[model samples]
Target: MIRPGLTVKLSLLLACIGVIASGATGYYAYRANRNMLVNEAELSLLTSTELLGQRFSTSIDDVGADALVLASLPSTAEVAQSDDGLRRNSAREQLANVYSSFMVHHPEYLQIRLITREHHGLELVRFDRDADGLVRVKGDNLQEKGQFAYVFDTLTFSPGRIYTSPIAVNHEYGTHAAEGKPTLRLGTPVSNAQGAVVGVVVIDIDLEGLFKRLQNDLPSDYRVYLANEWGDFLVHPDASKAFGFDRGRRVLMQDSFSVTKPLFAQVQSEVRVNGLARPKQAAGQVLAFVRRPFGDSEGNRFIVIGLAKPLDDVLSGATLLGNRIVRMVLVFSVLALFLAILFARALTKPLHSLAYAATHLFAGHAMETLPLDRTDEIGLLARCFDRLRREIRLQMDALHTKQRELAHLATHDALTELPNRVLFLEKLERAIEEATQRQEGLAVLFVDLDRFKQINDQFGHAIGDKVLVAVARRLKQVLSSADVVARLGGDEFIVLIEGQRSADGASAIAARVVNALNEELSVDGQSMTVGASIGISQFPDDSGTAEELLLNADAAMYAAKADGRSAYLRYHDVLEARRREQAEQAERARAGEGATAGREAEPTA
Candidate 1:
């Protein structure tokens, strides 16, 4: 290197002053910006976590509706009080159908069960939707679950309230449920007609599915995490780290996110704002979280749901703007060497303003946009960042709206908003599974509106459509919310009655169905009464398969039409046996007639 002269020394001195002044200014500006960004981030994260917690709580409350529905059913009452095996079996089977339908609409459920108070906690019915499909574990496969806290503890609870268990990695055996699933068990006491505690119905919700749904609408950059009251990671971005107990290891959220350790101490639910240190990763990592102390009436926390977004993603532009400001200060200092300090001061003020503006990303204000009128690179960079941040927010909102619509349209019926056939069958299969597990009987009533075609012909399709809608409304009025009433197609509806009940109980429901449809309808100011022909089939007494059960019910409905146009018929094995006997007798008579004719025609007998 050559030796420097006076001019070079002067230039070097100006550059050093510019660098030191700008560096000091940038340091303080960055600190203030980082702190501001962190505060905003904390607020945003805390708000999000609170909203998500409330959402989860709302979902559980909806599930509580399912529990109450199960508790109030007369079939559930039968399962508790009836002495007849067929009646009890039928009621248990019907209860299973109700649970299955509930699970169909709620895919997040892993298992829905009604456990009897007797037999070491005998599962009256359990519908476990496993990989194979909905499976009804029965006999040896259905274990005595009374010893479990969900079963035994719920028995002491009030009939209407739900008792939730600590979320844990599921260790359910047999029936081949998905291993290592994060499950939350909810139980409510089922009472007989006399209000005596009969059994406990428990719903095992798939926590992974539930949380994944909660996080799906969120920005892709956001990190969603969940831990139990004890801080075990129920859900984490890293699939391998989640439910660590299943892998014979402990992965506590407190250990993973150190700042969250104090959260467990707070009695009331709280959203904790934190700037955390991640030793293995970036040292600048910050986290904002909420600790929702969720539990049943028995006491304190059952689990915690948390949401976190990295400060790095939200304040990415801060780093770029800081760099640009430093560069601009140096260039100006070199050019205006005599006025270096004043030049640095002028630019530093704007840079600090940019820093302050960047910190308010969460502030929803148009004025919050930084001054972008400069003719230089710093102004351009700031403008671009502001636009980018706004675009991200808009995109997130659009994504959430679309996702919700798609999710709704996928499972519900378009016409009546009831569950479609696909969902109906899922419910049916679950009911079958539960009935099978409990060795209970259930009934599937196939209701076909008599002269529905005549009504459609007399009235236009629009009137016919209105009639169908009215019919759906009427069916709903008679049936409990726990019952599964689905429209299979035009003029056809399927109702699954779960739990143990006698043939008379099914017949009575079928009669009710026919009576429900007998009402006069005023469609376009025209009065028309549509009668129904209902066919009923009971579990264990009827054939298994969805097709077979429907076939049997359909066959019985045809028989009911033959007996009378507006009537209901209970399926019986004797009907099929009688038809077989009559056919055999006819064949014998034809053979005898053919023999007599042949003998007369023949020259030799």
Candidate 2:
């Protein structure tokens, strides 16, 4: 055989190296792409899980509010107090109608009952939804429930406070539709005029029904999981796994998903797991879990909400890319072998460019332009990277949305959704700066609710909360949209009015607030009224600083209260009187000092 030239030998050697290198790169790229896709899917699933938890909390609150409303009704209390038979009967009938109305509106409600603290927690009036519709049960049919936790635990609470019972299978006799079904009980104490807890208004929620509704909008493929504080699965895609503890043997989530053990211990608020990590329960899947507070209590009562998606679904794009990469490797090997003799040096630039882009793909900057216009394998790789960038940006946008929601929650009150002190001060400082620059003035109104404490004491904190919500709503209604209103803790709210620093202008706004609060209010069918005492202070005229302006307004508000409840006072009015008294005291001191000096100058020993 004739010996090949040196150039031919070099070409064959370079060709063999190119084939191996292309295959190795393809394998690694496939692995990296799979990881990236899994990460994005995990983040997305985690956000969705958190959102579901919030929705569940909101639903619980709604149920609690309904229970509170029933408990607060005067008729419910009247029946519970054991009044005259005729009067009690009338009240029961009227209240039963209201209960039926609620049941009609809320399909998820299994039963609504007023259980009296007396007669061993006898059900005074009850409405249960059966196979047909709402059925009213009364008289001898009303069963004693005092032995149940929902009744005794709720009666222990003060008026207006809600009690959320642990979710369980309802085994109560004569429960009709709720019998042997997963139930969540929300109860509030019903207090008579004497502020005695006479009865408990308890609403039985169909736990599965409620979650079904909550998850209606979720994708069909996504699986949901719920575990109680003990990690007992309360909800699972496979119904057989849920409520396993009720069946005797406990199936704990921590045991299934080992990584979730910290959640039960309150060590981690959230956790994400994937099949690649080889967590047994999460095999072939991606799962995200968030620990959510179960009730309004400060206790350790909580639930873990989780969402899972198939790993195969997450890797579908990666699979497609892998196939494309395999083909590209095969085509590029041939091209490399042909070009190796003359263009070996040219291949280094594209390979280096691809490597740099891959390394810095997530460094928070765009990759320097890639050679995407070329029809070669390098261009195909560049195009895949560009697509990957778009997918990442979409995931980032979702993360940004969740971040904004978290920031808003941090700055705003959870109850009233009004700006908290920190956020209010920030806004005030900005407003002050703007007003100073524009050479304009603004007004700050400090408002204190009168008789609120008395109402809170009589009704219980649950009703007190509703009263505050009502007050917040009224305040918003009284002020223009341009004005800012914030709750400064209990029974105190502050308002900022731009271009209204004049005494007349500020007083007019304050007057509107007082009048709005003074109007008779009806909550839960109980009539009550509250008054407002407002103190006004003007920016630039009162004080340039936000803190001083707030202090002056506070001082003026006290003056308003001193004058009488349901009144308004200006800071300047209070300041002028204080200034006169201070000046008189200074003059008197000077005169006394002069007299003392003259006596000393007489040299009388």
Candidate 3:
């Protein structure tokens, strides 16, 4: 019986479509924005790498220039020829001055060391700014044999051209002593006038500074790393004891090997694959890497710079937009449901009213009209219901009238036009109340036809019926207007007299009723005589209630039967006591019979 509303169905469908469209749009926007951010980050990283590479190349060039100037010195040639103390001291002083000037110009460089072309071993000198900014010569017997592998290798392999390599440098020089650490040394081979290698000039730049700069440039949510070709960490932001000399403990190199192993292998390849200048791949994470060579002429060294940004920040706005769209759809659904319910109620209100009105009309009540002002289908239904209600109301009215007539006939007697015993009792209660309020007595007289059953046995029941009906009419003719007479079934009739002065007054009315019933005759060509026994009981004197008064009156009428069946008796205490004595005597006689039977059952001896 329940039908769905059009508005609700449409709204639900629209909400579903809106949610899907919004989710799709949000997903596309998030992907586009994420891709744009990743491209921008890659460009920024490339620019930073190129800038850093230029800085490194320029430092190498400066070191080469200084090395050329030192190699051309006439004092440097004399020191190479002789092992004299004064010549060695002068060469050490000149080298110290050059190193001192280089340190002042490039503060990032820790120290600059110049090695000579002699087996006299190594000379140690430092810039002594405390001593009038001059070069101070130190021990000449200091051995450089074990610490100069990179320098020896450069000279042996590429004899004439400038060579640069990164090497571990000692930290015993002037400013380096205060720096409290060693560094990766950038060493360039010094060449003579004939373009033949003379010595090696080593420049120690702080690798930590480069690492810190790169770390600062990276986004807060991203991680950056610089690693060597061997996949060992040369510089990490959080450099601790674990990463000091234990190359195996480097987290960045291990992660790159595990996550981007293909990219790492491609960087190691001699030829580029896939048209990319540097091979890169993003697998389980979003990562960008660029590899640049960092040494000059001596050997090519790889510095892999990598950056990683998590995807959570990239997709956060998209997720929020999707959630907002879902919420809006839910809100719209609730609003639409509410409006749909209201509209449905408005549409069905007239039908519900018509149903209620039809129920009333079927129950034989007045029909109710419905408002038909609307121009919709509900309005037409209301008009039809109104016509149906009117037709049903007319049929109900005719049926109600017939029911009333039948009810009246069933409860009334045809001869006396008075209420029967059933109705008389009902009226008796009301009369009793009135009499009690008036401080007077009401009376119930039991009028019985003495030997009426014998009269019916002798004269036939049809004639008996006619005699009783005549008796009913004669009683009505004799009784005062204040008295009520009703045929109680068979030949028994009752008279209710209100406002009785006393029991004597009620007995006087009972005498009149007895006389009236004795005169009944003339039915079906025969004249019949029937005597009456009338017994009277006064309310508030004989019994307190209607039922008790009626019972006492009947008992008195029975007493009249014992007296000879043609007179009336007023109920009194003497009659009640005689009836109780007779009942006690009968009970004792029955007990005596029972005792005699018990005695007779004894066994004989």
Candidate 4:
């Protein structure tokens, strides 16, 4: 017969092994199921993104093709030449009939027109959309759009090439009939028989209708967002935030999700972990974004589109599987608990001493003297457990330390100990929200150190780093308690100033910042002088959102640099107009040069 001690040990060992093996199997299954669910979700979202992009491309293609057809019509060109009244009248009637018939079939076509470049983009023939519906605009009702990008930009493009305007708040004087309507302008050059571009056939698209087509067949739970090349929200689930440029503000994806910076930077196709949040009633999400390249461009480049959805919707079946596995594991655990209790009772007398020591040891209190002198199995087990507890405590302390370091690194620059881009954006967003609630104003300053690159080249990187640290310290010294400063990498920095009641307060703060940077300073005994170019964009004056404010400030900073370095420039609407006109003029010059070269190459005709 086996000894009683040997039998008890063998039986308990087998029971423990069985429980562990069952747990490991359950754990492995749970992990496998979860991994499978995550993979399925990624694939599903990616597929949906592909569908969304294709649908949008089709819509754009249809619009582009329509513009091209209208532009190519012989009657469309007749509206440009006023020398023949009878011919122009007949062309107008034909064009009006064609436009009216097409608008009926495509209700999203808000307006269609033939505009002549003769009188600075004067509308020659027109149809405008209003609350009542599509109405033909007669003489005097039509207005000049020479100042608009669509008219001016398309005038330079070769015949048959389509030009698109940036999506914006429809602020046309007559569009008061549909005030605040978001619109997109598509135009194709109208050329005469000689191929000389004389005018443009333009179309205005209702943005909401365009979005409706994109949303078609999408799940009800999904929220859609569309940003321009600059990351301004052209379309967002939040109606108020979309087309924020009309309100003199910006709502950018990069401000909300820093990981999405790549989408704009490199025109990347996809980015995971861009930041995910769901409505209260919705399940948790793991948002993934897919960038769709636009067929046409607003200015210099095409736009990148993004889409996101909840994980639960993507992996509906796996959630149920997870719940069932959890239930089965609980039942097995109950059975194992019963077996453990029976096992403990069989060895109770011998285990009593060790259990007493273990209970006090785990509770983190001192234990009474143990029977160490007995030299029995219980005593050996007690000694082993005490040593294990000491080792665990040491490891726990190390883990805690590492966790603290990681948390610190997440929000701060390791070298300067200043807030990084991610943390700065979060703080700025929060500050904007708070300012909105308090009905106060906020300002964002985009600061670029003047000639810091020369210093970096003169002194080694070690000294360059020291100079940055010194600059951070100086910025902190000049800032008020309500201000936040962050390095946006390289020599660029941003400052967020709050509690300002007007733009003047922000201006005062900016002046102080300029003065601070002007002070003499040295890093590592290497004397260096670095001033800053600051751009000021304020809430309610320049922009309504943090992202918009930052963008405006950046634009203003470039203006300051253009004017002269080491000064601040406040954002102005005229600044944007000047920039657009400059870009369009440059494009026009290039086109003219290419055309001249092509003509020169042509043999005597």
RMSD to the hidden true structure, all candidates: 26.9, 24.1, 44.1, 16.7
Rank candidates by TM-score, best first.
Answer: 2, 4, 1, 3
lDDT of 1 at 558: 82
Regions more than 4 Å wrong, model 3: 3-15, 30-69, 72-78, 81-92, 124-137, 157-160, 166-182, 194-196, 213-222, 241-252, 255-286, 309-605
Judge candidate 4 at residue 451 and give its lDDT.
Answer: 74
Candidate 2 local lDDT, 1-605, one digit each (tens)? 99986466667889888988998899999999999999998999999999999998899889989998888888989898883222347778888889999999999999998888888888888899899999988667888889988899888898767788877889988898899888888888999888989988989999889988988998888999999888889998888899998899889899988989988888899999999766576899999999988665743467899999999999999999999999999998998798787764555556566877788776545455677797988888888898898899899999999999999988988889999888888999999999889888989999999989988888888888888899999999989899899988998999998864443478888998999999988888777898999999898899999999899999999999998999999999998988999999999999999999999989976
- The sequence of per-residue lDDT tens digits that candidate 3 reaches over residues 150-182 is 567645534334555543324343442424443
| Sort by lDDT, top down from the best | 2, 4, 1, 3
lDDT of 4 at 511: 76
For all candidates in order, the CA lDDT equals 0.75, 0.87, 0.62, 0.76
What 10-residue stretch in candidate 4 is worst by lDDT? 274-283
Provide the clashing-pair count of each candidate structure.
Answer: 23, 0, 0, 1
lDDT, candidate 1, 372-462, per-residue tens? 7866777876787688788979999999999998776776666776666777788888888888898887888888999789988988788
Query: Given candidate 4, what's the lDDT at residue 271?
Result: 63
Q: What local lDDT score does residue 272 receive in model 1, on the 0 to 100 scale?
A: 49
lDDT assessment of candidate 2: 0.87
Candidate 1 vs. truth: CA RMSD?
Answer: 26.9
Over 27-112, each residue of candidate 4 has an lDDT whose tens digit, in order, gives 78876876677666656666776677667767776898999998888888877755122234876888889988877788788888
